[model samples]
Target: MSKDAPPHISGTPESSAKARARKLRMPPLRRRRLEFDDVNVVDKAMMKKAVGGTVVGNTMEWFDVGVYGYLAVTMGAVFLSDADKDAQLLFSLGVFAATFIARPLGGVVFGRLGDRIGRQKTLAITLIMMAASTFIIGLLPSYDTIGIWAPILLVLMKLLQGFSTGGEYAGATTFVSEYASDKRRGFLASILDLGSYMGFALGAAVVSVMQLLLSESDMVGWGWRIPFLIAGPLGAFAIYFRLKIEESPAFQATLDAQEASAKAGDETESLGTMGIFRAYWRPIVLAMVLVAAVNSVGYALTSYMPSYLTDSKGYDPVHGTLLTIPVLVVMALCIPLAGKLSDRIGRRPVLWIGAGSTIVLAVPAFMLIGQGPVATTLLGLLLLAVPVTFYVGNLAATLPSLFQTSSRYGAMGISYNVATAVFGGTAPLIMQGLIALTDNDMSPAYWLMFTSVAGAIAVIFMKESAQRPMPGSMPSVDTEAEAYELVAGQDENPNLDVDSLPFDTLGSQQGTQSDADPAPAGTADHR
Candidate 1:
């Protein structure tokens, strides 16, 4: 298969027909078609429920976290002293960063555990953790009530939630994608992402409503805890749905294979973190780079902006939240569009466009933050959402495509969480620190630009995994020659190569550079 022509459609009619006829000779697992035209063999029935199940589970998890962000002002009182607003915010940001730190560790522990045991059990555990922590947070006493211990307790609780999320998303996304029919993977993945965003959106709407109903004094005093408490119910409800769901067929098949080995039930064979760490470190690094901007810009542009408007721009928090509704709406609208676009063209070009636009627009976005009219801010939101959609949509589908079936859950979880923690998780704090240090929003712009550049660098190095057959690890390459060789390696057809393919004949660059393969001393485009 060439890079340009869809791998799903690559083989000649005669070859495809002969191959279909020869299906009887293949193993049951191998007999299933992995391309768009094939039926979804894994979880054919339960897989029908995978996307909805993932969304419900993710919605519950993000709802818990999003409530804190939406109620930042209220939660600040519980964690920081009134003596210093910026200091309090900084402290709260640290608390926020603590969760990211925990996320990767959780991913490692959970990924290894899930691989050792099953995705079903790990997801069940994560949902329970999320629900318990959220409920515990609602019942927590504030600083005035318990002094320093109250804040310390809050930090500990955040660690639990962070750990749960680290495992949950990667597990859920991998499960859903692995089980889902390839034809609709992007669409289904995008729908799952809605839960992540909607959780925040719902939190925003809830806080917005509370602000309208409650006096500012009341909200600051005790009203803020209401939103955090709400997450408990949502989490508990989601757990019921999550538990009812079955295990993914792919993971089950792997388990069956591993069990067939002489070392059956030997946990180490199933659960070695070192094996994963040493083998697929590139994807982990690439994931961190890829999601940092995705998560950070998510924090800086949307989450941090509300507080920014209230404090620096002198806008009413209520008015600012209301005005920013369009950004969310635009994001929701664009997310699915971007996902569909990637399905048609490719994930790499979409990701490249996302990185490139972020490079060019990072400064302008912040500069426009306080500029001319409400209309200008609206324009900025449109610009931000559209390019950002490209990244988010691609990420929704692309990251999972990088891993092999054997370790997809664990690899996806750890890499995604660690990247998010450093870049996304710490974004608000780091950007705010720069602003405080420099006395300008411009500093945050530079901070955002730094992360965006990392994402672009990541995109430059990433091989196009879209339209490629799954159950295979992403091949090593940044250019056409390596891509050609990679295709030749996996191709069922013995005679296929770059020069003879329709895609190459069509003169498509196919997102692969024209450079030849590197020598032993040369650089490889790892994460």
Candidate 2:
């Protein structure tokens, strides 16, 4: 045989075929070049308005949640006056869990609507529904007045609130994330949760004051209605802000691209519920796991802690509710700091800190709470807050990054609410049940530890998205100069992976460039 001739492989037919296959394989797709014009220049003023609007709505939603949570015992007594104390407490918590039952359905309906209509409009609708339902709950007739119908009406209103709330957080996060510049996304998005816990703290404070001032009969007879009634004005205020805001720029861009694609006769696949599931089930599942972990700790602190303190730890209703107020306020204040830290280091590292801290602090936090002094209880709550700060702070930024701009709202609605329904909303009841079943007060801690372990594992699989462009969108920067700088340093910027970006989805731009295209002047192709 001539020297140039191919030599025969000394292996079975399968090995020979495999060798041939390797030789014939296509080369990897080349990284796309980014031009200065390709970078999106964020409107700072508009971004701030968008963030404010979204945050206010989030705050209102959580305020309603906080009112319900802090008033769990009182609500039970008012609605189930015939039941034993334990039964009434259980009944109230059961009603609270019922709110989450409607979340998944709300998530699907509003999520798709947000994706279809616009984030701003859908958000306004959800806020109206949430506020109205909460206000109506305040006007609901008590068991004494209406007999069985009172609890039924109460549950119906809570379910309505749950339905609206299903859309609130997911839409808020998506709205802020899309509006924010990539560099400041973490810190900006974190502000939503800052509003969230602050709302919770406000609710606790209001309830605590009412408890101090009102007689027990007064609270049960009339005072409990005040907080829920307050939702009417707050919801109106949030709705006004939401209505004033425009659709998110990223989502608008996606819509524009879709329109352009249709005009040019390009086929664009619609990502409905099943389509989203089929296309992005992996990330959806991963996000659910992460949601489950963080919310377990979050709900345990915010929702369950008051009950745990009052019922199990032997604190009065007033002290139990008041004890968490300071801790929540402090933790809420620190959430943005953790978000900023995630921006500097990376999402995964900060998430690792959150997960690891939950594992380490869960048992100790419960132990300190069990000690029964104000200082020890505060310290325990603070320990629980540590992991919550790291975890919840970054979620608004991290979860949205998992999916593309086109389906992010829908995907988030499904993933977040489902996990919340199962783990988050049920956390209070579950902990209560766990303690009863095991006859061990530490059962809640063990549950938290288990969830954190799962969270840690999920973190390993999550893509590091800090300081990176969201999928299906252009690189977003705060200013024209920043856009130019990003393009100039594209090759050297580790976080900006041009190859991974879905440039094909950028509509008309897809046909304008190819692998052979050279980098724009002043930019180097180092990949």
The candidate that wins on TM-score is: 2
lDDT of 1 by residue, 190-303 (tens): 766767767667777877888889988787777777877887778778878888888765455455444544365433233256666566677767878889877777777556
Could you give me the TM-score of model 2 versus the true structure?
Answer: 0.90
Lowest lDDT block of 10, candidate 2: 510-519
116-149 per-residue lDDT for model 2 (tens digits): 8989999999999999999999999999999999
Those runs of model 1 whose alpha carbons end farther than 4 Å from true positions after fitting are 1-45, 263-268, 473-527
TM-score of 1: 0.80
Lowest-lDDT window of 10 residues in candidate 1? 512-521
Report every candidate's CA lDDT: 0.68, 0.88
In the order shown, the candidates' Cα RMSDs to the true structure are: 12.1, 7.4
Best by lDDT: 2
At residue 239, give the lDDT of candidate 1: 79
Scored against the true structure, residue 522 in model 2 reaches a CA lDDT of: 28
How many residue pairs in model 1 have overlapping backbones? 1
